[model samples]
Target chain A: MTRAAPNPARRIREDIEGRIHSGEWKPGTRIPIEQELAARYGCARATVSKALAELVAAGLVERRRKAGSFVAHPPVHSAVMTVPDLAELIAARGESYRWEARAILRRKNAGGADTLQIDGIHFAADEPFALENRTIELAEVPAAAEANFAAEAPGTWLLAHIPWTSARHVVRAVAATRAEAAALATGSGAACLQLERDTWRGDRPVTHVRQLFRGDRFDLVAEFQAGTGKREGN
Target chain B: MTRAAPNPARRIREDIEGRIHSGEWKPGTRIPIEQELAARYGCARATVSKALAELVAAGLVERRRKAGSFVAHPPVHSAVMTVPDLAELIAARGESYRWEARAILRRKNAGGADTLQIDGIHFAADEPFALENRTIELAEVPAAAEANFAAEAPGTWLLAHIPWTSARHVVRAVAATRAEAAALATGSGAACLQLERDTWRGDRPVTHVRQLFRGDRFDLVAEFQAGTGKREGN
Candidate 1:
């Protein structure tokens, strides 16, 4: 009937995970030995070992036989597909993030529901990071019809407001068009990464977005374990 | 010990899955209704429904409220990262695949182990599809040293001959340099999709490869479900 006591092994794992996630323990930084961690946490060495093993399984730590464990490199990969918030991604890189809306349009769909389309640019450290075009189905998200997207990125706003059920991402590289080049501050014909995403809430479509990023600045990375079907989301 | 009889529902699910995977049932093809499927399979309607439900959960089928289930679109997405065999991929597209080794170099590492480096071009239907540069650590994959890469791609060869423990992929867009442009039969500065991958056997590195695909021809796709972290391997 009462709450169960917290597991020490889980607590230790979370503590180490927190440090790694917060960037306090950079990649390659040595984690304390099992004996040292046991002494510090006032737990058995097996408990510390269990926590470290979990971290290793999660790809957050690497254990060397004679040497101690070390924080694994921060993965550049996203979950195969994820709806990441660009503002958060930029901020995490220790850069100032900004979003500027270039155009906004509201129109009626064939079903007589409103659709909101937005054109915008995202900046990191005052440099153009990506150009985005997004459409929101107002019938499914009526609140978006009145949202002030010019003052904030709609993607960020939508994440905080809507509950998405499924998403699809198509990633490709293309020559930057003149208009896209002008907006992204890259040379026309330069290679660029283009990502198109469609999100749905159950059977209804919620939003569709296309974002273009400068070839020099952005990339997608993914890591895999042999014979494992499971992947962690970003 | 005796093998248990296969569940009817599982049999139905596997049958449909095989058809979908084999491309016999293209995307958007409507599946027979439960009653029809039940009659065909000589099973109860509930069993058919159960099989359909499993297919839906696997993202291989889509069920509409008023309409029948349909074969979902072929997902372009790969498991976040996979060590795919290029020959198989090209052949799947019904293209004549060719592997041309432009150059091969063998060197000694600091540890005095042999390292083989290969530069090659992959052709699909007589058109260059990708430019590949690969390095294999012979200490981990000794068979690679004697492999006849001129007749076969090392990527495909490695996939067949070796067992890898893990892999990392970095995807980016890049402007093709003059040499790359010539090799890929594209104009200089044209957009290209570059994928750099490193595969390992346990803790020892096996191979490192970089492939450049024409921006217009190649892309990566991924699909995700809300609140779920599991991703299928390609």
Candidate 2:
């Protein structure tokens, strides 16, 4: 065979990914044998094997020792998540909203939020607001967080970003600190609500969020279609 | 004209999306004008206009006044995401999945640990014997939190049966509160690290995630590919 040059692994991986992306290989469908991939990519069997390994690392395909490498699923959602102007979320529901950025600190990588958002951005911390948190009216959205949420809460504001979307939320029990817990309201071991949400508009994720609802107040409500057969899009 | 119960707007949108996903409409290609789409879809200009607007809302297309609608940049990744079993995650890497159920709350979705989870299995806030919050070690899948992570991080276990091929991630900054700040080892006014991930294998959105990191000891890394623009699956 007039062989292709080096970077065989890259070529094979790309080829496999392209096939899956193009729907030539559907999720759960097995890939060609290592022997077959080698023949097609014009590389040694080991190189083809390595390419499959790379796909595994990328979480694009699965390898079953005897069953062979198979496509993971199908076209997964491609989320274009954005920080919605808070006011827009609330106002969309015909509700009014407000905000306040408490104790703003432009920190490089601050901790305290949920794990999903940690690798995402460097935030400007809070200030001038009691409890060192931002509040919102659930009605207005300027370019960014604005006003003091004396009357409105940030959680309420942020959650309104999407209408009739699907979410997987988590509420947990945690020990609260003196200042921070007091700020968001609740008590130590009082078990504040740690609400994490992966909000989706169809399959496109609108936002992934983790919030602490005051343990003292606030409740979680989730209503499923039970058996809608197949869920519909928003 | 013999029309087939024309939904010109709908057809136009599907055609554009098909072209984009099928690699016919390359990225950054300026889409045709409303008049052009009208001609192609055999519909009035307004019909084509509506279709494009809908695409924009769906995050699959973008328009720039006179610039016209073009396919928005697809997410860099095309991984199928799934809500996987934490044990499966680690075991897949040749490890063990272990955890202790701290508590299971049953409620109408209000207050404390019962406040966040809403799927109605109630929630078992678990303490992972081996837990990975923001970072899932490749050697060890760690724990993926699906809902009430305080008791049981869902990533530690799989609730649904789906295969994933790709993963999408987003990060951002948020202010910390007393309770959450204390748990994450940050100050009330400090910035926190957040990570949101959506994973896929093929076309299905198998899993959607939002993870918060202990900002004090977290880092986000990026591995870029050469400029070979591709297409989005979902």
Candidate 3:
């Protein structure tokens, strides 16, 4: 079946989105009414309505019952989890950033099954050092991953090379294993925080990483606006 | 300023969304092309494009470059976080749900600056028990909160009484404070999983809760899809 070469509604949608994205139409600014837009585009009123509806669903525009529509006041549904950078995180808190890689083993990471485990050591004088254990799958490792892993930590290396499009994170509490306690200079079965991250590029998953942090030394803080109905797994 | 009455494009968008939401249009199923949809809806082709674009933004439909649109294969972007119910969580795991309220204090929850703390006692046989400290603003505390706190845990109470439309959660790892160790029956320096949740009812903030979990016994898991350009902060 033949399709319209240049879908007028799509073109109009792109035009408005371009303005919004490029900052031409600032947040909360009102765009022209459908009638005015229809006249400008020389299209039917329905066409303008269709284009605006696209912007509305995208959270780019807000439509009130009787107030027409305005560029949405920038949604508040975003979740911020900074890229995993251990040195930067510690330095941000004005603490000395010290890292020691205990081991790096190559393994398969097919179907989200992880294969490599990297240990990050922290220097805690007279205190239990945190244990950060990360496991990554083999398939997701980049071509230069081995060299990068040897030169620096895998998390740091992956951050520099891989450009992931999406990521999911699960945070949980768990007791430190006996080995973990010894490694972190704590008692067996101490409390700890575990963070699991899965990153993907389009439909292809790039890597899944599991990190265990010594509970006493770290905290993750995030704030978000509510009720946009955008789910949390981005 | 005049608007078109009875937005035909909106009607078309809703009709399509309803079918998708109701499972009438199964995932991976391709509905009629835009030409056919426009004809069937008795609207301009642009009107149908607008409706389909909404579905695409919502992750409900996929539009190919030239192949037209189809119901999206079920999205993986949905973040699954069940309501915070201690009893229900335990029961769902095939274990008996048991909870004991240790303390409930009246306090202020100003601008998410929590002032109330709720302690949930664990019935652990020998493990280090966790303490949940919740601070809420006075403004968010409902009129009947005191009564509810005396009768049951505030978290459970708020879940039942307040109809929160949105929630934000921040997870972190932290060392237990001296008072916390004594209250939770663990060492003062022990590790813990801290969860801070702020709930809201529209523009009105409702409650902010912070819970410390015994690291050994709890884990939160969430999964999501990739490449919807919604930022982390909406």
Candidate 4:
């Protein structure tokens, strides 16, 4: 199959998106008017208008009637319910990533079954980003009992090995405890975002994890339609 | 059509749900064993087990292999993207709700169009719950210019008067600034959950709002299936 030429409108949209994403055009910075952009790109004014309109719909730009269009403030949005791999997330942001296993323990549960508990810190760009505590039911995933977590985060390992059928997320804000502050290198009572998650395979629980993120470093975003209660671009 | 009798399992589920909701059974309290519950309710052991399983699925109870089930810790969960009426939310919590409009201003936008700005505080049980700042585009909703915000919250009024087609939400955790702390009746540097929302009617922006919620008072919850990218029960 032969590829078709890119649409001019889409090309212009992507070009503007790149500028915004690259921080070349900061929020509230006004962009060129339709006529100027059309002249610069050798495209019709209508094409540039279409590009700007699409950007507005995508929440990348805002248009005022008499004033020109301007870049919209960028709020990093993440799917609230998805289990994102922190390593991949950091890498995607062009930051160095590191995982340190602070502690790991194996113990017998009330049912005399083996369980593994892990405490770790995820670093982005050599700075602590999140402190994580995770527990795995060894009976459900016996390999976890022997798996070496020093080299990898348990969340990364579980996402690779387990086929989770369902998940629940509880998100809250909290003051950083002294222990959390020391681990995250933040002052005590600093704001933190706490996310508690549980994943299951069919009827069996796979893992339960709690992650505390530096409030300044993370946030969650979701877009919704009027009646569907579904997120945009899902 | 006449409603059929409720299923016995569902009746049992609702009974247990009611108990949890009423705070009669606190978290970590062990519930009766299947046999004991069956005997108490005059039901089969299998029926009681089914009810407990359903409760586990609902995240209301947790079961261990050899240990009996226990009530799970409850976290108040709100939809992160939904524009909930704070008055209703507080009322549903059995708290007396009050809306106090701190300031209201009418200004002209860059395009020489009217805009309305509102600053308000929401109180639940006579304690400050949230500090809110909102801006409404008068061109989009002229009725807002005359609405008596002192008597009703702008959010509740907007929900009743306008039909928003889409909305974007950005959620973050932050330490409260002095001004916010004063309004929220919390200490400076206290953790707060900040939610910024922009709603649009078709392609026109209708309103933008920022609300700072006391961290100890609120949280969000979402449940999801493995692959659909859709929230459960949505």
Better candidate by DockQ, 3 or 4: 4
- Order of candidates by TM-score, top first? 1, 4, 3, 2
What's the lDDT for all of these models? 0.76, 0.45, 0.60, 0.74
On a 0 to 1 DockQ scale, where is model 1? 0.24
lDDT-wise, the better of 1 and 4 is: 1
Share of real interface contacts recovered by each model? Answer: 0.58, 0.01, 0.37, 0.53
- Per-residue lDDT of candidate 2, residues A1-234 (tens digit): 555876888878877777766556767887888998887878899778867866764457778997888876422232222223334433554655445443433222233222211211111122111121222122222322342334444444344332223334332434456755555543443344343545443344444544444444433221111111111211
TM (B chain), model 3: 0.55
The clash number for model 1 is 2
Q: Write out the backbone clash pairs for model 4.
A: none
Across B74-172, the per-residue lDDT of candidate 4 in tens digits comes to 322222232356665676678886778878888999878898999989888889999889999999889999999878888778766663346777778
Please tell me how candidate 4 rates in CAPRI terms.
Answer: incorrect
Which one wins by TM-score: 2 or 4?
Answer: 4
Question: Model 2, residue B221: what's the lDDT?
Answer: 23
Docking class of 2: incorrect
Model 1 Cα lDDT, one tens digit per residue, A70-119? 98753323334323577766776799877788788889889989899998
Candidate topping TM-score: 1
Q: Candidate 3 lDDT, tens digit per residue, A1-234?
A: 323336888888878876765557766788888899887887888879867876675567877766787877643333433333654455455666455777877665445554676766654343434555666555555454455454465555665554333566777766777988787766676667777777665555666666677766566554343323344421
Better of 1 and 2 by lDDT: 1
On the 0 to 100 scale, the lDDT of residue A136 in model 4 is: 94
Residue B150, model 1: lDDT of 72
Task: Give the TM-scores of the predictions, in the order they appear.
Answer: 0.66, 0.31, 0.52, 0.63
By TM-score, the better pick of 1 and 4 is 1
* Prediction 4 global C-alpha lDDT: 0.74
Who wins the lDDT comparison?
1
